[model samples]
Target chain A: MTEPILSLRQVNKSFGPAHVLKDVDFNAYPGEVMALVGDNGAGKSTLTKCIGGIHPIDSGSYEFDGRPVRVHEPRDASALGIEIVYQDLALCDNLDIVQNMFLGREERSGMVLDRASMEERALQTLAGLSVRTVTSVRQRVASLSGGQRQTVAIARAVLWNSKVVILDEPTAALGVAQTKQVLDLVRRLADAGLAVILISHNMNDVLSVADRISALYLGRMAAEVRRADIDHTRIVELITTGRSGDLGLAPEQTGETGDPDATPAAGGSDPAGEADAIRPGDAIGPVVEPAGPAETPTATDTDDEVPA
Target chain B: MTSVTPEAPQLDGPAEKPAVGGPRRSPADELKGHLQAYTARVRGGDMGSLPAALGLVVLCAVFGTLRPAFLTAGNFANLFTQGAVITTIAMGLIFVLLLGEIDLSAGFASGVAGAVLAVTLTKHGWPLPVALAATIVTGVVIGLVLGTLVARVGIPSFVVTLGGFLAFQGVVLIIIGQGGNIPITNETVLAIQNNNLSPALGWVLFALVAAGYAATRVLVARSRRRKGLDTEPLVVSAVKVAGVVAITAAAVAVLNEERSRNVMVVSLKGVPIVVPVIVVLLALGTFVLGYTRYGLHIYAVGGNAEAARRAGIKVARIRTSVFVICSTMAAVAGIFAASRANSVDPNAGGSNTLLYAVGAAVIGGTSLFGGRGRIVDAVVGGAVVAVIDNGMGLLGYSSGVKFVVTGLVLVVAAGVDALSRRRAAASGA
Candidate 1:
């Protein structure tokens, strides 16, 4: 495998008695999208927080460009060209796009805000990103739709020319068209040769965009596999039972198997046909009910276009 | 780009076509578009300076009809002096209010500064500049202590300033000692209230001020257009310039009129010294809050402090600096108060001064919740308060009626603020 642009090795974090992250190992290569997938309490957020420097890890080695480095704060991470587009977007609703784009790091001309240059740069960045939904950079964020706000937030992160950008649920609250816009933007980011760590619960989104998939279960890294080598059933099995045949961590070590009913029904005895066996009717019967125009965007637009 | 309608389906979509919040409008329709957008916003509950402006016009019209003397130049000049101290204090409070914080002690803090000035000048026999400097420094010191406690120590600003309010009042009492009044006799200090420029000089000053205001608007409009940004039409800009000229010309005309009586013709003409000082302060306040990076930081911090912190802004420092500015302005207000009264009495900075300042800020359309106010709010709101008091006095209404009326005005302003905020939230959400 090619060396990753950013890596975290045996990263451990604790909140007093609660061990939020347990010896977590993660990495993202340059020019590739790494999908971090997990269920609730799987420590995906804790891990990302550690990476973003919102929380200092209890013990871990964070490496950048294949060299060990220390990131004690968000500023430190920013200095190293690591930017996190947080789930909340972290934008001021009262400020305009140009102001929000350069919130803290405002450009100035001898004590006054340099509006012309800043506005020009902001316009150039949005144009480069091909963001057409936002009609004006002068519009206050309070007036923007969710998708447009997400676009602005992503544009802001990429505007600083960061080497690695971590997006936490970029499409969680978006409409079908907005999600497509964001996913396209995501691909453009990776195509431009920036490392991207996408944390998401949407399995279809991950499978469609991720070049590498890393699954975490119970605060531990269960498996790190190339996108081509994995299937949906194996990933779900690894998430629920912490093992998918011999590839993942042994199930015995976890001391609890996944739901007995769900395991046999979902993860078939044969590893290769598990996805096929579970699909066709049994898996999607309930979830796909009344699926018409409502599901058309997320289902048809993205589901048919899986990663090559 | 794929969807014809890009707006969120769940959220409130724009009612009109693509013109509102859309890309640039044609130069011919630019003004109309702005008006449409403004009306939409107002309907959506974001009434900007409309209420304060409307209230001022109504008050003037009503008071002018009721009392002939209410519209006189002498009465306005007197109102200007009375509003000066409170306006200065309100201007400083704008900084505090912008951060979604409050300083209850500001009124008494100014009293403390005034007391210090009085004692230093009268008892210690210090020079005017030295006394003024000491008074301002004392105000800064008070601000530093309060700001540090609130920002660094994480105490609630309400509680910190409440403590400051009581403690500073004590300091004021102590400085006054057994006697209640410490009269100020310095010629320069006295001049702040007693002096006025000649009628000719008032016209020149009026011309200069009007010219400056017009120049700034023109320069900003030109720069914005040069950068390919949207700007108001030249006719609209010209209208605004003309409006300022007309207002200043009328004010100068009234003030320059002779106030001579039948027995003795004494011409009490020209703008008061305090008017120009207040104008300068307003200009500085507007510049700092509108044009500087630090001002942008202030807005960002007020809007969402956590977001500002994530953006690498020094949130604590910004919060601290705002408090310092508030306290320093409070000190300036105290000096003005002493100068207006020509004495430093125990009742100088206490009583309803703080309330008036805060009321003026809110009444002027500044949001109490922070992230949405301007220094002009203080000026406009302060004038509203002064006019109410002055008008009531002319009508022979007691202080009791005045307080009740002022309270009602405050409630109405607050209601407007609350209603608009709720509308914005409902639509945004």
Candidate 2:
């Protein structure tokens, strides 16, 4: 019902001749969790990097809060209230929670760091996030568990009044308990009225927290469907094959779109389309289990061949 | 969407309470908590300065038992001056080491600066200030060149500094004219190492230092409390302040004793001027590393360069500036070396000077892996190196034996660093 706080239209990015992101459109609405799902090499990271201004989009219009904006670097994105938590978390392990939370944009009174004020703000932010596992704000990040580190990284993003916070595979390395903790925190960020873009490989995580699912299939925008309108199998289908019934790209446009000359028969025969319709009905019971490992290697093999 | 409202109540319940800075505990409980935390941290492989402190104590005990002279007040004063140059240079090395980079040329770098000082002061008849300025400028210039090569030109620091090491040795030889040495006759220059502060002045300085330290702690605590944040317990603060005062008072009292062989001939009983110089540098260095934005950036850059870059820190600039700081400090150390010898030679800051400095930093608990060091590490580590050198000489050991022993000590220090790093990783700390 409400307009997206952050939106990208017809975004394209290239790495030499690879064409990593091609005509991708994405949206993140305030007070909603938008899960961006894809296989490896599906341009999820590239799109997030573009939004965070770590990479300059080759051709795109990035609109924030109803106005076209230009983000030349990470600073520009942060200036526009966009923060990104990379899969690595980007935290300095030697620093304490307060220090890492305010790594670059430290508060200072004159030339000296304002320790009292920074500590106060850090305490309030953690409390506001209901983060209780960390015993002390002064606890070095090296001593923190995986879940606590994720909390610190997410809290760092939220500290600057950021409107859109993008997380890349936040729970990929986390244990089950930690993953649940991080997922809960992700939901809380959205509940707090921030646009949260969650990049995930887990179908359960996507189905659980996401209000809108935007699937990226080999550099193209496959589909952006509401959670209520889609089932787990359909979402996985879209991710794996770039189409689920009538929900995603047409068969002609889906296959070998990056290089049209390489697969001329892919558009005419519609083998992928026939395969999609027949497989979804029969594979619904064991969709996620067989689909993940079985589909990834072949998908990646095709991906590697395209770039070469 | 139905699950959201139920979670709102749970979030608000805990969100209203400050997770840290919870209900204030009694002093005893707070102290217990602090001790437990420290022990836990040690177990987690964050053994900062613990091994160094223990080594210093063990070394002192062993040397004291072996040689009674090592325990005397006169020898204690000797130790300060002996360690001053190495400690000063090691202090500078900490900045470079913090970035996980090595400057092998630091020794020859100091040699070059010392030669500059000797030439300007003795040959050119330059004023003390002018010579000092020239000496420091020489250091800064060397740093800029090394830093530019490493940072801007993308040469590995070890390689760049190694080339500097060989070239600067030649530069020093050229400046000192092969085997020639220049004698420094300037009173002020010579007095930096030879002279001591008056006993009264020493006491006054002790008072000022103690008061300043206590005042800082109290003010910080008060400000923290006023801001409704957690503050260290009053008892803990008092203990820390008392520890500082006790150590300083003991040092001042020991140094203030009559250490001269004959009181009538010449009285030598005050804190060495170098002590204050080291203390000042230590204070300044600690403040910059621990409390300033620039210092935090250095740590961030060292800890994770990509993260730091993404955080908007200029990694190259930090990389370059540290070299500048290291070289400038080496210059100061060179000046101290020249003053201690009362002359400048080609050997000034040559041979084991850089090794001793690097060993001091490592022995003090500065990690070779970087991002985990303090200025105080250099001082403590320098003391370890000084005691070994002084004690070996006192025990009539050959330079060969002493060098082997010191080398073994360095290896042990580095071993502790690597082992502790592994422990940290294992413990997930």
Q: Candidate 1 - CAPRI tier?
A: acceptable
TM-score of each: 0.87, 0.91
Model 2, TM vs. native:
0.91
Query: So what's the TM-score on candidate 1?
Result: 0.87
Winning candidate number (TM-score): 2
Once superposed on the true structure, which residue ranges of model 2 sit more than 4 Å away at CA? A256-259, A262-308, B1-18
Categorize the docking of model 2. acceptable
Best by lDDT: 2
Tens digit per residue, CA lDDT, model 1, A226-287: 77777888888877766686655544334353322211111111133212221211211111
Q: Give the per-residue Cα lDDT of candidate 1 at A288.
A: 16
Superposition error at A205 for model 1 (Å)? 2.4
lDDT of each: 0.80, 0.84
